[model samples]
Structures are given as C-alpha cells and as structure tokens.
Target: MNQLGSIIFLIAIFLFSTFLNWYVFQAVKTLTFGLEGERMKQIVAVSYWLIFGGISIWLVITFLRIFQMGEINVQTQTALNVFLTVMVTQLVCVVFLFGEDIVRNVQAGVTYLVNGSNGFSFPERMRWVSGIALVVAMIPFSSFIYGVTKGKHNFKVHREIIYFDDLPDAFDGFTITQISDIHSGSFTNYDAVQKGIDLAIDQKSDLFVFTGDLVNHKAEEIDPMLDQFKKIKAPYGQFSILGNHDYGDYVSWSTKEAKEANFLKLKNQHKKLGYRLLLDENVVIEKDGQTIQLLGVENWGLGFKAKGDLEKALANTAASDFKILLSHDPSHWDEEVKKNMNKVHLTLSGHTHGMQFGIETPIIRWSPVQYRYPNWAGLAEENGRYLYVNRGFGFHAFSGRVGIWPEITVIELRKTVSSME
Candidate 1:
C-alpha cells in the first residue's frame, strides 16, 4: 500500500484500540472500586497501555517491513498475531461490560421516568457484572496464552477407520499416516517438531503422505530441519505434494529465473527428505499381488493455482482401481474431485490448518475457516467420495494452535465384507 493508505490504516487501528482501551479501563475501575489500594488500578493501567502501545509499535514495524521488503517477516507476523489475540480477548470482555452498562442505564432511565424527580434515585454500578465479564474474558485469554506457549506442538493423533466395499482386499487393513501444511518456515523448535514426527513414525502406518505446504514460501526454510523430518518413514514409502505456499507466490522475486529456481529447490527439498514429490501423477503400490493407485496433484483450489490435472494424474488407471488422491486444498475435492467421472475413494488435503484456532468437540466442531471452505477440517463425504482434511502439522502466522491442535492423521482402510455387501 502507498504511504497515505498505510497511514490511514494505522490511524484506524489506533482509534479502535483507544476506544477499546477506554471501555476496558471502565470495566476494570468498576470491578476494582472497593478492592485493594491503587496497586491493582496501576497494574491494570500499565498492562492496558503496554499491550495497546506494543501492538501499535508492532504494526508500524510490520508496515515498515512490508514497505521495504514487500512482505512481513515471520517473527513480526507472529508478534502481531499475539497482540491481536490479546486485543480480541480484551474486546470480548469489554463487550460484556458495555452490555452491562446498557442494562444499568436502561433501568435507571425507567426509574426516573416512572417516579419523577422527587422520588428518582440514581442506580449504582453493579460490580458483579464487571467481575463476571473479567472472568469470562480470562478464559480465552488464558487459553490463547497456553496455545502460544505450548499447544503449537501438542501433536494429537486422530485415528479414523474408513470402510469401502470396493477397497482392494490386499489394502483392507492398510494404514496411512498423513500430515499436511508443515509450514516449516514458521517452526522454531526442532525438538518439539521432532516429537510430532516421532509420534507419526510410532504409528508405523503402512504409508505416509504429506498433503502440502512443507514450507511457508521458500525451500531454504526447511533446510535446518530436514534431518528431523527425514526420520518419518513408512513401509510403503513417503509421498508429498506441493501446497499453495510451496510455489513462492507471496514473496517478491527479482526475476523469473529466481522464482523458478526457488520452485526447483522446493521440489528437490522433498527428494532430500525422501519424499516422492508427485506432480499430477499416479503411482501404483502393490501388496500381495493386488494394487491400489496413489494419485497426487499440485495445489489446486477454486481460486488458487489450477496446476492439478486430475485427468492427467488418472491417465491409464482403471476405473475399478481403488484410488487415494493427495490434494492440497479441500476445495479441490468440493469443486472437482467429487464431480469427476472416475471415482476417488479417498482424498487427503491440508491447506486450511483450521485457521490455527477454533473449537472442536465430539458434540460440535467449529472454525472460522468453515465460512470460506465447506470442507475446512476433518472428514466429509459426498457421493461416496471421502475427503480427510488434516488440521496441519505446523502453524503459520499465528505461531500457535488453540483448540485445533496440530494433528497426525492415521487412517485405516477397511474392505467391505461379503455379508455387508
């Protein structure tokens, strides 16, 4: 953005933060009215300014970096995310306090109008409302703090059993461990990341697949941690496909050759990590004289790069073959895979990363990403075709995973029995 645009954006942020801070201060004062000395008051004052001021500084730095380099660095982005989370949580608290103010004001207004000036009495602020608002806000505040400090690498194994009548007999009990959107560029701890890889290896799944986004936008980002990820192995082999970030579309390049070189290096990085980087191609895996097709495509989505050619990948493949496709974006399945002439038994994807934040429970699952992509996370089926959207193995801009913990997906393919048929 130009200087004028940047300045206007920053001003808007400042004004919003100012208003939010005012509401927060009122809530805090009301809650702490008869409590301890000015100590609590001073602390709240310092904290509010420290957070908002730090955010403003971070925003300025971010825009400066963008102006200079045409992109924000990962560290700055992470810092911004932290501040933004805190800001949002504070806003949530203020909203409740604001609601309380409205109710109290309405009650006071009614008393004045009903009794007239002679009998009218001013209503006192209810401290309990502010207290409750604070308590409620602290829940998310604490959750986000935990998410940033530790939950990013809290790898959870999601075990799923999928049954298919047409599944090849040899692959009936086959297990596939999948991880997606590694985004190594955003990773800071090798040992923590290694723990996740170890967990995947421990599953000893027959096959391993990385759906996409091995790095944020550059191949070199994975250089430091290549050895750590290389430890992940499966009996069938490790296969990977590029995600949107793997193409270096977000960063500025000096020349076309430089961009091409970066892409080549990313492809080579997959090879270095011992992954068969499939580009719109199919590989047949045989077990006990029976075969299943593993088809992979480049990142394809409704609005993303349409590099994946399903027809080219499925070329020469039998229609009756049990096919498992590795696609980066779940939208690919929503838009094309399900509608394809040939049946794709299962499709694996990992582009959403569940927005790195959301609530997921047995009773209900929700994420902001759902608004954009219907198949945002977990498993969904339509027309007998299955799509498993991995929550992602690593975080991106937020540098944290809240309720949607990073996942190592273990899928067991079961063949439908004759009795069931």
Candidate 2:
C-alpha cells in the first residue's frame, strides 16, 4: 500500500484498540470498586494500564518494522500473536459487559417513565457481571496460550483410505505420506519440529510428497532445520511442488533478479532435502510391473498464483493411466482439476491449514476457513475424483495452532473389489 493508506490503516487500528482498552478498563474498575484500601486500587489500575500500554507500544513498533521490512521476523510474529490473543479475550469480556450496560439503561428509562416527577439515575455497574465477564474471558485466553506453547507442534497423523476403481493392481494398498506448508521461517523449536519429521518417517509409506510453502519468504529460513527435514524419505522417492509463498511474492525485493534468485535457491533446497521438485511436470511411478502417473504442477489457486499448468503436467501421459496430482492449493481441484478432461484420479493439496483453528470431532467438523475454501481440510470427492488437503506441518502468521493441529497424512490407495467376486 501507499504511505498515506498505510498511515490511515494504522490510525484506524490504533483507535479501535484504544476504544476496546477503555471499555475493558471500565469493567476492571467496576470489579475493583470494593477493594480494601486506596493503595490496592491504585496498584490494580496502574498494573492494568501498564500491561495494555506496553502491548500497544510494542504493537506499533512491530507493525512499523514490518512495514519497513516487508516481512515479519519471528520475534515480531510472536508478539503479534500475543497481541491478538489478548485482544480477542478482551472482546469476549466486552460482550458480556455491553449486554449488562444495555439492560441497565433500559431499567433506568423504565423508572423515569413510571415516576414522571422524579429523575431516574443510571444504576451502578454490577461487580458480579464484570466478574462473570472476566471469568469467561479466561477460556479463550487459556486456549490461545496452550496453542502457542504446545499445539503448534502437536502433529497428528491423519490416516485415510481412498478407493479407486481404475487403480493399478500392483499399486493397490499403496501408502503415500504427505505434508505441506512447512513455513520454516516461523519455526522456533527445532526439537519439536524434529519430532514431527520423525513421525512422518515412522509412517514408512511407499512414497512421500510435500505440497509446498517450504519457507515463509526466503529460502534461507530453512537452513537451520535442513538436516531434520532431509531425513524424511520413502521407498518410491520423495517429490514436491511449489506453493504461492515459495515465489517470494509477499516480500519486497530490491530487484526482480533478487526475487528470481531467491526462488531458484528455494527450488534447490528441495533437491538438497532429497526431494525432486516438479514444476508443471509429470513422472511415472512403476511398481511390480504396474505403473501409475504422478503429476505435479506449480502453485495454482483462485486469487493467488496461477503458475501451474495442468495441461503441461499431463502431457505425454496416457488417459487410461491412474493419475495422482500434486497441487498446493485446494482451489485448483475445485476450479480445474476435477473438471479437467484428463481425469486425474486423486489430487493432494495443503494451503488452508484449516485456518490453524477449528473444532473437529467424530460428530462435527467446522472452521471459519470452510466458508472460503470448501475443501479446507481432510478429504473431499467430486464425481469419482478425490482431493485430500493436508492441514499443514507447521504454523505461519499466527505462530500457533488451536483445535486444528499440524498434520501428517498417510493415505492408502486401494483398488475397488468387484462385488460378484
């Protein structure tokens, strides 16, 4: 954005946050009105402002740094996460407080109408209402804290069995391990990340495929944990495809050549990690005299990068061959892959990360991202084609995961058995 626009946006955010702080402060004051000593109340008021003021200052500085740098550093990202967590918790408290205020005003108006000769005064704020608001706010505050501390690296293996009518006989029961959106720049705990890599290795699938976003902005971000990721190997070989973030589009570079150079380095990082990076290309995987086609395209998504060429990836491949495609964004499947005449049997993607927060259980599955991307996570089918979107292996802008933890997917491809047989 331009300078003026940036300034306006910052000013808007500052005003909104200050308003929230003031409302929350009022609730705090109401709750502490009956404190035993004047000094104790003074301390409470001072402590509340100090915390909020410190966070406000930190947010302004970090936002300025991000605007200047065109990218957020790990420290700044963590601080932003903290800011969001606290803000959201405060908003929850505001909801209850606002409700109580509305009721109080209504009661005062009723009293004025009933006794026309005497004026009605606004009632005192109830300590119990403020207490309830504070108590309820703790729920989300605790969840956000846990998400940052542990849930980000809490890798969960999602096992799926996909059946294909035209699957190659020799490839039946084939297991493929998939992970996506590593976002290496956002990682802080090397050992925790290693544990996720180790879990993927433990799956011991026939093939491994990474759907992309290896780094947040620059390829160098992966340097620290390169060795750990390199250990993820499979019998059929490790393959990968690019995601939108892999192209350095989000960062402002001094020159076009610099951006290109960084992208080339990121591509090479895949090779160094023993992955064959496919850019709008296809390869054949043969096993026990039967073969299947593996096609990978560059990042393709609606409203994002459109570098992937499905036609090019399918070039030189037979229409009758069982095809598994690797595309980073799930939107590709919704927009083109499933509708393509090439008849791709399966597609793997992982760009949503389920918004890094949601509730998923045996009875219900829901996330805000669902409204944006219908196939945000797990499996979906259209006609006979299947798409599986991994929930990602690492956190990103938020620096944490809530109900939707990092995921390592193990998919077993099964051939349909004839009922007559």
Candidate 3:
C-alpha cells in the first residue's frame, strides 16, 4: 500500500482506540460516581483504556511503515526545513493544547463529584463537560502529516575515528565505506539512488561493506540499481552479508524453493557486482604489508532479528589477530560480541539503521529506537569494544524521515595510541 493508505489505516486505529477508551471510561465513571462496585470497575476500566490506546498506536505505526518512501537529499531537507518546521510546530502545539484541556476536564469531573457529595454547588460540572468538548475538537491536529523525508546525499567531511583498543595495530588507519538496508523497492527514481552510490564511491575508502536488506523482498527490487552498486570500489575489496529481510521472510511465495533460489540469486548477483558474499564465513584482507581477518557472520540480532552463528564462523581463528566482524545487527555487538566473544574486537553492523528515524539536532539528539537500545544512533562504545551503526544508504517502509535523513557512512579506523595518561 501507499503512504497515504497506511496513514489512513492508522487513523482507523485511532478511531478504534477512541471508541474503546470512551466505552471503558463511561463504565468506570458510572461505577465510581454511583453507588456501585467501584474497585472492580477500576481494574477492568484501566486495563481496557491503556491496552486499547497503546496497542492501537503501535499497530498503526507498524502498519503505516508499509508505505516507506524514497529518501530525499540533504539539500532538499534543508531547503524544506523552514516550511516543515512551521507545520510540525503548529501541529504539535494544537495536539498539546487539546491534551491540556483533556486533563483539565478529568480533574474537574472529580472535583465536581467531590464537592457535590460535600453539599457544594454543581455549577462546575458544566465546565468539566465543556473542557471535554474542547479536547475532542483537537484530534485532527494531532493527526497532522509530518515532513518525513529528510533526504540522503549531503556530504560533509566528518573527521571522526571509530577506534577499539583491541584493534590489530596492522589494520590501524583503515578507512571503510559501508552501506546497509538499501531496500531499493522503496528507493524511487534513478537520480536519488545514483546520488547515494556516488557519495559512497566518493569516500574512496580502502574497503567497502554492505551489511544487508539490499532489497525489500524479491531480487527484482534491486535489478534496476545493479550497475550502480557495481560501481562502488575500494583498493582492498567489497564484502556483504544477508539481513533478515533478504531471506524473503515477510512475503508469501509460490514455493519455499523459489524463495531460496531468489536469495541465492541475490548472492550470485553480489558476486557479479564484484562483492564477496560472506555467508557464515571469513575473509582476510592483505593490506599495508599485513593481513587482518574480516570475519563476516550471517544475520543475527538480540530480539527481533534472526540468529546466525558467529562462533562457528570464527572457529578457525586465533584470538590474537586483528579482527573486524561484519554482523548485520548492532544488538549482536551488545548481547554477544561484548561478552561471550570478547576476542572479536572491532565490529561493523547496520540492521538498526538508527531505526531509520532519529532526532537531527545538536542538543539532546535521539531516535524513536532509543527506547529499544541505549546506544541507538551514530557511533557507540562499551567495554573497549567498538560498534558503528550506519544510518543507511537507502530508505525503508516509512516513506520519509523526519529528523533522521538516510545516510552514507565513511569510517576511518585508527590504532590505539601509545601515550600514557
């Protein structure tokens, strides 16, 4: 479905939540405000109210994701920032205004009942009802359409080093260009895709890595951009891994063999494009008169992602070598690489894509996925280990980004210095 259609479905959820909350609210009010079993009513009422609204909102958001649009350029996002700013600001203001009145009415309802019981006047009840009316009037503003696409191809040289103490000294100063979640099915237009690939090529990094989800579902989704992806080059080589979406898990197919064939075809296609497909295996990049083991594990994640064995892939290795692991999901860095396999020092991952949406500001930066993981965006460090989550080279199901634009990340690896504190 299209973005507008998915948004309409969310509106349906909003309506359902409204009805459920109202029905439950009325039932509770009657029990509490009258001579009835108020305690039982409170339990059931609270359950219905919270569950209905929360679940509905979640479902609506998830469903609306099917409309993921093409990414816009950074220039475009900045150009439209002024107008989008006004729209988002005014819309949020209106939503909050009604939200305030809703709170006032609830408080007033309790106030009126308490006063009436104590022999005071009932005049305040009308005010409570009027406040409720105002709250109801503000729902449309809360449903405003935000400027979702923050755009993709803005190039600023970020001279940052993503380092790890355990990194092999031989591989220090290694620069790499990484792409993940291209999802070309949703990437609309030749110009945008070309621009994104051009940015990656312009980095001129030693090695290039593609983490996964190259297409949304089938192989055909990416055929249009095959030549563009082949253009990405590095002195060392290019490597890739599979993402959960690449397995054709989300769609219904004629047969399992056909789906498997499609995935294998994609793997072969990667080979045709001069990328080494890493399927639960490892590759050694010989550079700078030394070799560093590049261990590429299959798809794996903490909760939502599929599991692929990283240990089996690294079984032949010595713990002392400088190692860089390419695992699709960043959550793997926290759950597995950080502890169970501490030997894997520098890990590169991209399943999160910062959840494809994050706050784009200097102060108090954040993304919605922040609720899911502590180290949710940009570069993350813990326990002398390093994980860099790419924002992504392509767009996905949401069709547009608000603050978080689609990204092309260039990372330079530096060796740990010898100076003492």
Candidate 4:
C-alpha cells in the first residue's frame, strides 16, 4: 500500500511535468517573442498553465480549509479533509470547464499580438507593449471562472474507420458507443449530459460502453442525476469497466477492508443501473454464427494500479478471432494490447477525459488535453490497429466541459476486404 501511494505521487508529478514545461515555455516566449504570434502565444500559454495549475492549487487550499478551520484532531482532520476536498471539488468542477473560454480568448490574443508585434525587437519597447496586452488579456482570464459557471459544454464529434476487420454476418457494421469519467456530482447542468447521451443514442449503437469514475467518490454524488445517466441505454446493453477513481483510491482511508467494501458497494450499484460490470474478464457476443470477443480488464497500467491482466482475460481464445478490448487508460493500449495480445482489432478507452480541455483555435480554442494524449480525444489508428479514446461523458473535479465537451463515441466496426494500407 505504501508502495502504491509512492507510485501515484510519482505519476502525478510525471503528468504534471508537461503542464509545467508548457507554461515555462510560454512565459519565455512571452518574454522573448516580441511579435504578434509570440504575444498571442504568450496569452494562450499563460491561460493554459493557469487553468491546470489553478484547480490543483484550489484542491490543496480546500483540503486545508476542510481540516484546519476548526478544532479537529490530526486523524479526524485527515478524514474530514479528504471527504470535503472531494465533495467541494465535485461541486465546482465547472470552473475547470470554464477555462475553455479563457483559452479561446488567449488564442485570439495570440493572433492579435502576432499582428501587433510588427517585428520590433527593442527590449524596452517590447516590455511596454507586452505588459499592457497581458493586462488587457487578464479581463478574459478573470471572466473564465464565470464562463465555466455559466453552464456551457461544447464538443466536436470525430468518427472514422480507425480499425477495419472482418465481422461475422450477424454483426457487420456493428456500432459501439463508449463514454467514461462522468463525475456526476461535479456537473452543474444535467441537460448537457442528456445532450451527450442523446448523441450516442442517435448512433443506434449495438453496444453502449461506459468506463468508470461514474461519480465523484460515492454513489450519492450521482443519485440525483440518474435520470440523465439512465438515458444511455442501447440494444446490446450498457457495459462498464472501472478506473482508478472507481476504486476509491484517491483518499486516505482508515481501513483497507472499508475501502474495498465501498468499491464492492459501488459495483453493485452499477448492476442496478442495468450495466454488466466486466472486472478483469471477458464476454463473447454471438451473431450470425460468429463470435465477437469483448475483454475488459480491471484498472491495470504501468504503476501501482488495479489488477488488469489482459492475457489471463483472453487466455481461452483460439489463435484467430475478432476481438475488442475495454481497458480504461490508453496506456493499456501500449502496455497490453499492442504486445503479446492477439490481433485485437478495435480497443476502446476513456481515462483521458481529454482531461476535458482540448486545443485552441480561432473559431475554437479549448483544452490542453490534446498535448497529453497523442490518441487523446478522438479515434486514432496506426500499424494495423485502432484505438478510440472517448473525451468523456461527465466532468471531473470541475463540472463543465470547455472546448473538450463531454463525449459519447459511436464507433462502427465494419468488415473490410481491403487492407488499411
């Protein structure tokens, strides 16, 4: 257990390192690139850093307030702090979503500054111009919190023939809609969730898949929003696999037994929602005398995570068969699927959430999630294999989605005689 805690801390640093690097680069660019492109880049770069850094900083602050404001003992304070931190984070997740507009405006500023630069390299003149523009851009920066609170969730839908393999006659053109990380307690608006679910349902999916982190930390966080989630039903049934959050792995727990008990309870609740919980296991869906093997592993990855054994899950399979894997993290695509595993045609995952913030554009400036996952927010295929990383169905610590709106991915698997050459 101590080893796991150390591992998580290290992974957090590793992931956060990208954010740190991005910000430092922007700060230097803002200081050096006295041109419009540089200035605009500066705004965008700062905005991106602030959004990622701000939430984390706030979470730390919340933890302190929850335990420090009153006269609580060290042990009691620790428990309360963990609970309140998760709760409050769940309550105001929209702030994180709101960072999108800030990114958009900053991206726009990048364009403006690029033109404004006019190629003047005098340090004294450059400082004056950048300082003023940076101040003006702060207007949008300050307003970003408001935009997130204002209840806006925007997204783009990208679907394609990422992986093409032969399917049995019964399941040609089989469409599977998968979504995950619906941290319901954090969402401010239920309607946005409904819209995403509606989009998935529109695909007439044969199977509806949900990777975990359905609620903040407890079932009650989402009890009020079941109506929205319940809307995600399909012909092949809604199936789910757990993520790290689903296992209650984020906090300091009193007893290992209690934590494991909570996980079991959450798993049971999922069953009540009409979902087949696939924990380190596989199930075969038969059609037209052909079998499509669906293998789901527990939350396994390169660190101190849950036990997700893919080989064990697919041990009984014959050498050749149509296969699809459901492992939440895309890292699994690298760690497991791309290795000794069979020619798994299509692998579906959603741990990224795009982190819920994508890239910035003129018409669309959004999240930094793209920089994190190469196969980050959409369908990606390479080397005769494919992976669809769903942006996510719900928000995380912040309630809303900015440029990276929550996603409902409808992936259609078709039999192709022609190779993807």
Candidate 5:
C-alpha cells in the first residue's frame, strides 16, 4: 500500500481503539464505586491505562517501521499480533457494556412513560454489570494468553482407521503420519517445536508426509529447524509438496532470479529434512507383490498459484490403481482432484489451518474457515473419495492457536471385505 493508505488505516485503528478505551474506562470507574479506600480503583485504572497505552505505542512503532523498512519484519509482526489480540479483548468488553446500557435505558423509559414527568431520573449504571463484563471478557483474554504460551506447542495426535474395499492386500493396516503448514518463519520457541516433532516420530508410522508450507516466504527461515525436523523418520519414506508460501510470492525480492533462487533453496530444504520433495510427480510404493501410486502436485488452488498439473502427476499410473494424492490446498480437491478423469481414492491437504482457532468436539466441529472452504479441518468424503485436512503443525501471522491446537494426523488403511464374499 502507499504511504497515504497506510496512514489512513492506522488512523482508523486509532479511532476504534480510543472508543473502546472510553468504554473500558467507564466500566472500570463504575465497578470500583465505594470500594475500600480507593486502592482497588487506583489498581484497575493503572492496569487498564498501561495496557491500552502500550498498545497505542506499539501501533505507532509498527506504522513507522512499515515506512522505514517497507514491510513487516519479525518484530513488527509480533507487535501486530499483540495489538490484535488485546483489541479483541477490548471489543468483548464493549459488547458487554452495550448490553448493560440497553438494560438501564429500558428501565428509565418505563419510569418516564408511567410517571410522565421530566423529573424522572436516569437509572444509574448497574454495578454488577461491570463485574459480569470483567468475567466475560476474561474468557478470550486468557485464551489468547494460553494460545501463545502453550496451545501452539500443544500438538495432538489424531489417529483414524479407514477401510477400502478395493485395497491392495499387502497395504492393509499401512499407516501414514501427516503434518502440514510448518511456517518456520513464525517460530519463536525451538525446544517446543522439537517436542512436537518428537511426538510425530514417536508414532512410528510406516510413512511420513508433510503436505505443504515449510516456511512463510523465505527459504532461510527453515535453516534453524532442519536438524530437529530431520529426526522425523518413517520406514517407507518421508515425502513433501509445496504450498503457496514456499514460492516467495508474499515478499518483495530484488529480482526474478533472486526469487527463483530462494524457491530452489526451499525445495532443497525439504531434501535436507530427509523428505523426497515432489513437484507434479508420482511415486510408486511397492510392497509384497503389490503397488499403490502416491502423486504429489505443486501449489494449485482457486486463489493461489496454479502451477500443479494433476493429469501430469498421474501420467504413469492407471485409473484402476489405488491412488493417494498429496495436495497443499483443500480447494484443489474441491475443484480438480475429485472431478478428474483419473480417480484419486484419498487426498491430503492443510491450507486452511482451521483458521488456527475453532471448537471441534465429537458432537460438533466448527471453524470460521468452513465458510470459505467446505472441505476444511477433518475428514470429508465425496463420491466415495476421501479428503483429510490437517490443522497444521505450526502457526503464521496469528502467532497462536486457540481452540484448534497444532495437529499431527496418523491414518491406518484397512482392506474391507465384500459383503457377498
């Protein structure tokens, strides 16, 4: 964006933040009314101003950095994350305050209508309403804190057994572990990241697959985590495919050559991690007198780079073979994989990351990303074909995961017997 556009956007944020500050201040003032010795009042006042003031200062610093450095660096990205989460907490407080006002206004209107006098007094703000707001707002506030401190590293291993009637006999009970969207550029805690990798290694699955997005926009970002991720070994092999971020499309490079060079380095990093990087290619995993095709394509989706050629990737394979596809974006499955002439029995993806936040339980699974990508988060089947979208092993711009923790998926393939047999 131009300098003028940046300034306008910052100004808009300032105005909204200021309005939220006023509501929060008013709420605090009412809550501390007649409290013991004004000590509690002073404490709440100082805490609120300190946090809000810090946010304002951070906004100014990030705005200046954008003009001076021309883009958001790591520091600026972190500051922006803090600003957004705190602002969300303020918004929640505003909603509760508005509800309190509605209640007060309704009571005053009833009094005025019945008495029909100008002397009818406006109802005082409900003291308990402030307490309620504090309790309610704490929900998101604490959640953001936990997400940053722990949720990002809280990797959960999801295991599932899927049965196929046309399965190869030798591949029955074959296990695969998949992780995606590493976004190495966003990592801050090294030991925590290694812990997640170790958990995946502990699964000891037959095959390991990293669906996409090894870094944010630069190849060098994964340099530090290479050794840690290299330890994730499987018996069959470890394979990977590129996501949109691996192409360096989001950053400004000096020249086309430099971007191409960076992309090459990212592809090499996959090899360094002991993974066979697949770019619109196919590999046959052979076992006890049988074979299954594992086809991988480059980043191809509705809004992303359309470099992947599904037909080309499946060239050497036959339609009757049991085929599994490793695609970066779930939209690729929605748009191409399922509808292609060659049937892909299963497809794996991880682009949405479940928005890194959502509630998923046995009874219900919901995330904001569902509105955008119908095949988001977990398993979804269409026309006997299956797609499983991993929640992601790492985070990006948001810096945390709320309800949806980082995920590692372990899948077991089973052969189904025919009912007639």
Candidate 6:
C-alpha cells in the first residue's frame, strides 16, 4: 500500500485497540474499587497500565521495523503473539462488562422515571459483575498461552478412508500421507518438529505428498530441518508443489533477479529432500501394469496467486483415468478443480491452517476461516470427487495453534465393491 493509506490503516487499528483497552480498564477499576487501602488501589492500577503499555509499545516498534526493514526476527514474532493473546482476552472481558453496564444503566433510568430527581444517584459498578468478567477472561488467556508454548508442535494424525467408484483396482487400499504448510522459518523447537516428522514416517503410507509453504519467505529457512523432513519417505514416491509463500512474494527484495534466484534455490531444496517438485505437470505412478495419474499445479487460489494451469496439467490424460491432484489452496478445488471437464477423483490441499485457531470436536467443527474458504479443513466431497485439506504441519503469523492443532493427514483410497460388479 501507499504511504498515506498505510498511515490511515495504522491509525484505525490504534484507535480500535485503544477503545478496547479503555473498556477493559474500566472493568478492572470496578473490580478493585472496594479494595482495603488507597495504596493497594494505586498498585493495581499501575500494574495494569504497565503491562498493557509495555506490550503496546513493543508491538508498535515491531511493526515499524517490519515496514522499514522488511524483516521480522524471533523477538518481534514473540511480541506480536503476546499482543494478540492479550488483546483477545481483553475483548472477552469487554463483552461481559458492556452487558453489565447496559443493564445497570437501564435499571437506574427506570428508578428515576418512577420517582423524582431529588436525592437520586446512579448505580455504582457491581463488583460481582466485574469479578465474573475477569474470571471468564482467564479461559482464553490461559488457552492462548498454552497454544504458544505447546500447541504449535502438538501434531495430530488425522485419517480418512475415501471410497471411489472409479478407482483403479491395482491402487485399491492405496494410502497417501499428506502434510502441508511447513513454514520452516517460524519453527523454534527443532526437537518438537522432529517428533512431528517421526509421526508422519510411522504412518507408512504408499505415497507421500507435501502440498506447500515449505518455507515462510525464503528457501534457506528449511536448511536447519532438512534431514528431519527427508525422513518422510513412502514406498511409491514423495511429491511436492509450491504454495503462495514459496515464491518469496511476501518479502521486499533489492532486485527482481534476487527474488528469482531465491525462488530457484527453493525448488532445488525440494530435490535435495528427494521430492519431485511438480510445476503444472503430471506424472504417472504405475503398479501391476496399471497406471494412475498424479497431477500437480502451482499455487492457485481465488484471491491469491493463479500460476497453476489446470488444463495444461491435465494434458494427455484421459477423463476415465483415476487422477489425484495436488494443489496448495483449497479454493482451487472449490472454484476450478471440481468443475473442470477432465474430472479429478481426488484433490489434496492445505493453505488455511484452519486459521491455527478454532473449536473442533466430534459434535461441532467451526473456524473463522470457514467463512473465507468453504472447505477449510478435513474432508469435503461433492458428487464423486473428494478434497482433503490438511490443517497444516506448522504455524505462521500468529505463532501458535489453539484448538486447531497442526495436522498430518493419512488418506486410504478404496474402490467400492459396486464399481467392481
């Protein structure tokens, strides 16, 4: 964005954040109003402002550094994470506090209307209401803290068995393990990341695919953990495709040639890890004299990059053949993949990371990202086509995974008995 637009955006964010802080501060004052001593009240007030002001200043400095230098260090990322966690906690407290104020004012107004203004007084803030607000706010605050400390590396293996009527007989019961969004630059704990890689290795799937975002903005990010990821090998082969971030588009470079060189280096990293990096291309995996097509396209999504050529990727492939597509963003499946004339039996993607935060249980699955991408996580099917979106292998901007932990997806493709008959 231009300089003036950026300034306006920053001002808007500052005003909104200021409003939230003021609202939460009022609740804090109400909660401590009945304290025993003047000194105690002074202490409480000072502590609250000190903590909030410190985080706010840190965030402002971090953002300014990012704007000027086009870089974010580990310390800056940590500050951003802390600011988001605290802001979310304060928002929860503000909800309850606002409700209490509305009810109290309404009651006071009714009393004044019924009686006269003589010796009338507004209702004092209730300690019980403020107490409840503070207590409830702890739930999210604690959850966010744990998410940063542990949840990012807490990988969960999700398994799905999809039955396809047109699947080749030889490939029946074939398992493909998929992992996406490795975001290697954000990793801080090497041992924890190694454990996640070991879990994927244990799955023992026939084929393995990495759907993208191997690095955050540069290829060198994967240098430290290259060996760990190389351990994920399957019997058939390991394949990969790029995500939007792989092109180094997020960072500002000194020259166009520098960016292109970085992109070339990233592709070479995939080969170093023993993966066949597919760039709008197809390769056939053969078993028992029968072949199934595996097509991979570049990063293509509705709002993001559109480098993937679906038609070119499907070139020379028949409609009747069993085909599996590897695209990074799930929107490709929703917008183009499923609707293509040359049908793809299955499409694997992983870009949302389920927003790295949301509630998912046996009963309800909900994330804010769902509003943006209909097929945000897990499996979604339409007619005979299937799409499985891996939650992600790592975290990004937020530096944490709350309820939506990092994921390794294992999919077993089965051919239906009816199709054989």
Local distance difference test values of all predictions, in order: 0.88, 0.93, 0.67, 0.63, 0.88, 0.91
- Least lDDT summed over 10 consecutive residues: which range in candidate 6? 66-75
Report the error of model 4 at residue 170, Å. Answer: 2.9
Per-residue lDDT over 321-403 for candidate 3, one digit per residue giving the tens place of the 0 to 100 score: 77778888888888888785537767777766666545667786877687887766567767676777776666555555555
TM-score for each predicted model, relative to the true structure:
0.91, 0.95, 0.71, 0.68, 0.91, 0.97
Q: What TM-score should be assigned to candidate 1?
A: 0.91
Selected candidate, larger lDDT, 3 vs 5:
5
lDDT for each residue of candidate 6 in 82-115, tens digit (9 for 90 to 100) = 9889898999999998898898899889989988
Q: Which digits, one per residue and each the tens of the lDDT, describe model 4 over residues 67-174?
A: 343222233333333333333333233233234336656766776677675753323223433344445444444343433554235534556554355666577688
Off by over 4 Å in 5: 2-5, 35-47, 63-73
**Model 2 over residues 19-83: C-alpha lDDT tens digits?**
88889998899988988999999999999989897787778778888889998778788778988
User: Candidate 1's residue-wise lDDT over 217-285, tens digit each?
Assistant: 788999999898998998999999999999998777899999999999999999999999999999999
Candidate 3 lDDT trough over 10 residues, lowest sum: 140-149
Error of 1 at 402 (Å): 0.7
Q: Which residue runs does candidate 3 get wrong by more than 4 Å?
A: 1-95, 106-159, 164-170
Top lDDT prediction, candidate number: 2
**Judged by lDDT against the true structure, how good is candidate 4?**
0.63
- Segments of candidate 4 deviating more than 4 angstroms: 1-60, 66-132, 135-147, 150-152, 304-306, 360-372, 418-421
Candidate order (lDDT): 2, 6, 5, 1, 3, 4
Better of 1 and 4 by TM-score: 1
Q: Judged by lDDT against the true structure, how good is candidate 5? A: 0.88
The clash count for each model shown is: 0, 0, 11, 15, 0, 0
Q: Highest TM-score, which number?
A: 6
Alpha carbon lDDT at 342, candidate 2: 81
Candidate 4 steric clashes:
15
